[model samples]
Target: MKVADFHYERPDSLAKALVLLSRDDADVQALAGGQSLMPMMNFRLAQPDTLVDLNALEELRGIREAANHIEIGAMTRYAMLEASDLVRKHIPLFSIALPHIAHSAIRNRGTIGGSAALADPAAEMPALLIALNATITAVSTSGERKIAAKDFFLGLYETALDEGELIKSISVPKALIENRFGFYELTRRHGDYAMAGVAIAAQHMAPLTGLRIVFFGVSDRPLDVTAIAETLEGQSATDTDIVEAACRAIGNQSLHGDLNADAATKTHLAQVVLRRALRGMNA
Candidate 1:
C-alpha cells in the first residue's frame, strides 16, 4: 500500500506550525525527521489529511547545558546528541545508548522528539529519558507545559501529549558526581531493535543508595521497576543473589514477544540483559 493523498504545508515558524496544527477540520501530523513516520505512511499504518513539516523551526534543535539540567531540543538528531560535548558531559547515559539506536544513517536522520513522540516500546530514547528522570517540554497554542518522562509514555505508540501539542525539548538533570549508570540491550544484530533492554541509574554503591531501572522491548511501554529496584537498597547480596532477586521481581509483568521469541523467552532474555546492566555499571 502507498501513503494516501495528503495536503502538505511547510510553516516557516513555530507559531505558523501551531496555527496550522490547530485546524480541527483536518487530521494533521507533524513531520520532523520522518524515520518512523515515513515508514508508517508507506505501510498505510498512518494516513493523515495534512502533513505539517517542522524542519524549518530552528527553535527545536541543539543541546545546551542550562543551570543544573541539560536542555535538548526535540529536533536534535541522535548523531547530533552523540557529537555534542554538552550531552556527553551532562548526560553520559545518552551517549551510552546512542550506539544502539539503529545504524549511523538512522541516527543522522532520527530526531529525539520524533523518537519520543513515536513512543515505540522497543526504542531506546523513551526508556533512557525515564531512567534519567528527564522532563519533556510540550508546546501548544495555549502555552507550554512540562511533563515528567515517567508520566509522558502512556502505552505503545501513545503519549501524554494533548491534541495539537508537540514535544519541544527535553530536560535531564546534569549527572552528579555520585551518580552511576548501567545500560544493556540484547538484539539479533548490532543495530536491530532490542529484544530486551534495560537502562539503570543509581545514586552510589557500597550500600547502594538509590536505583531506577527501566526496561524496554519486553513490554508495551517502557516499564519502570522502581518498586522492584527499591528492594536493592541496603541489601548485602552477591551478584548471583542480586540477579535472582531482580528476576523474581519480574513476577507477572505481562511481557510481549515478537515472531522471534515467545513471552517466556523474552522474560528470560530480560533477566539476562538486566543482570548484565547491573553488573556493568559506570558513572
Candidate 2:
C-alpha cells in the first residue's frame, strides 16, 4: 500500500532542524536509520507532513569516552557501535546486545538513538541502557535536558520526548566499570523480535554489591527489578538464589502468548534465562 505523500527535509544543522520541528503545523518526524519508520510509513502507520532528516547534521554522529561516562552521538548507527573496539572494551553490553538486533543489513543503518527513541520494548538498546543505568539527553528549540533511562521510557513505544524535542545523545555512566554483563533473548527465528528477553549487569563483589536485572517483551516498557537486587544482597548468587529472583520477577508478569510460547511457558523461560544470565555473570 502506498503511503500518503509527505515532504522530506535534510537539515544540515541542529538549529535548523529544531526550527523546522518547532513549528506547530509542520507535523515533523525525525528520520534516523529509517529502518523502523520506513516500514511504518509504507504501511501507513505514520503520516507525517514533514520529515526532518538528521543525516547531514554533523552534531549527531560519534562515540566519545569522557572522564566518568561514555557519550554516544544520537545518530551513531548500530553497526558503528558493533565495530568499534572502544565500545566493546568499555561498554561490552552494547557489543553483546548489538548482534541480536534485527540483522546485519538492518544494523548497518539502524542508529542507536533512533532505536532508543522508538522505544521498542523488545529492542536490545533500551534493555541494555536500563541494565547499565544510562541517561539520555534530548534537545529542542527551547533547550536541552538529561533524563535517566528509567524515567525516559514511559510505556510501550513511548518516551518522555515532547513535541519538537529530539534525542541528542546518550550518556552511560562508568561507575561499574568492570561489572559482569549478560544479554540473552529468545526469538522464534534470528532477527525476529524476542518472545522473552533478559539484560543483566552485576558487579561481582565478595558480598555481591550491585545487580541490575531488566526484562523486555514481557511488559509495556523494559521491566527493572531493583527490588530483586535488594533481595539478593549479601547472598552468594547461587543457582537457587537466581532461580528465586527470576521466579519473583516473572510471577505475575504480563507476557504475551505468541507462536513461540505461552504465558506459562514464558514465565518458566524467564526463570531459566535469568538463571543463565546470573550464572554467566558469576562465571
Candidate 3:
C-alpha cells in the first residue's frame, strides 16, 4: 500500500524543522533516514499530515568528540557508525551491536536517532545506550533538554520527547581503561529483530564498580536490572555470582511474549544472554 497524501517540507535548519513541527493544525512528523517512518507510512500505520524532512539539516549530521563524551548527531546513519573509528574506540558496544541491526541495505539508511526516538523494544540501540548510561539531547521551540537514557524511553514507541521537540544528538561517555563492555542478541536470522538481547557495561576496578545490565526484546522498554546491578557492584563477580544475579534479575520481572516465543521462553533467553554478557566482561 502507498502512503496517503501529505505535505512535505524539507527544512534546511533544525530551527526551521522545529518551527514546522510546532504547527498544531496538522500531524507533523520529522523524517530522518526514513527507514522506519517510511515503512509505517506505507503500511498506513502512521498517517502524518506533514513531514518535516531533516535530511538537509547539516547541524544534525556528524560524529564528534565532546569534552568527555562522544556526540553523535541525530542524523548519523548506522553504516557511518559501523565504520567509524571513533565509535569503535570510544563506544565499542555500538560497534558490536551495529552489525546485528538488519542488513547493510537497511543500515545505509537507518539513523541512530530514529531508532532511539522510535524506542522499539526490540531495537539494539536503545538498550546499548541505556547500558552505556548515555544522554539524549532534544531541541524544541521552547528550549533544549538533556534526558538520561533511563528516563528517555517511556514505553514502546513512546519517549520523553514533547510534541514539538526533535532529537538533536546522543552523548555517550568515553570508555575508561577499566571499563568493559559486552553485547549479545538471539535472532532467528542474522538481520531479523532479536528474540532476546543484553548489553552490559561494567568497570572492573579492585571490585566491579559500575555495573549496568540492560535487557531488550523482552520488555516494553529496555529493562535495567538496578537491584541486580547493586548486588554485583563492589564485589568480585564469580561465575556462580553472575549466574545467580542473572536469575534474580529476570526471574521476577514480567517479560513480553510474541508469536515467536512465549514469555517463559523469552525469560529463559534473557537469562542466557545476560550470562554470556557477564562472562564476556571477564574475557
The prediction achieving the highest TM-score against the true structure is 3
In model 2, what is the error at residue 24, expressed in angstroms?
A: 1.7
Q: What's the lDDT for candidate 2?
A: 0.84
Query: Taking the tens digit of each residue's C-alpha lDDT, what string does model 3 give over 22-75?
Result: 998889999988888999999999999999998898899889998789999999
Q: Model 1: runs farther than 4 Å from truth?
A: 236-238
Residue 74 displacement in candidate 1 (angstroms): 0.5
Which stretches of model 2 miss by more than 4 angstroms? 175-177, 258-260
Off by over 4 Å in 3: none
Candidate 2 local lDDT, residue 187? 82
* Angstrom error at residue 94, model 2: 1.2
Q: Which ten residues in a row have the lowest lDDT in candidate 1?
A: 234-243
Which TM-score value belongs to model 2?
0.94
The ten-residue window of minimal lDDT in model 2 covers: 201-210
lDDT of each: 0.88, 0.84, 0.88
TM-score: model 3 vs. ground truth = 0.97
Q: For each candidate in turn, give its C-alpha RMSD to the true structure in angstroms.
A: 1.5, 1.7, 1.2
Q: List model 1 lDDT by residue over 1-283, tens digit each.
A: 7788999999988889999988888799999899999999999999999999999989899888889999989999999999999988889898889999999999999999999999999999999999999999999999999999999999999999999998999999999988888899999999999999999887765566677788999889998876665677866545565566667767657888888888999889988998798788832
Error of 3 at 45 (Å): 0.5
Cα RMSD for predicted model 3: 1.2
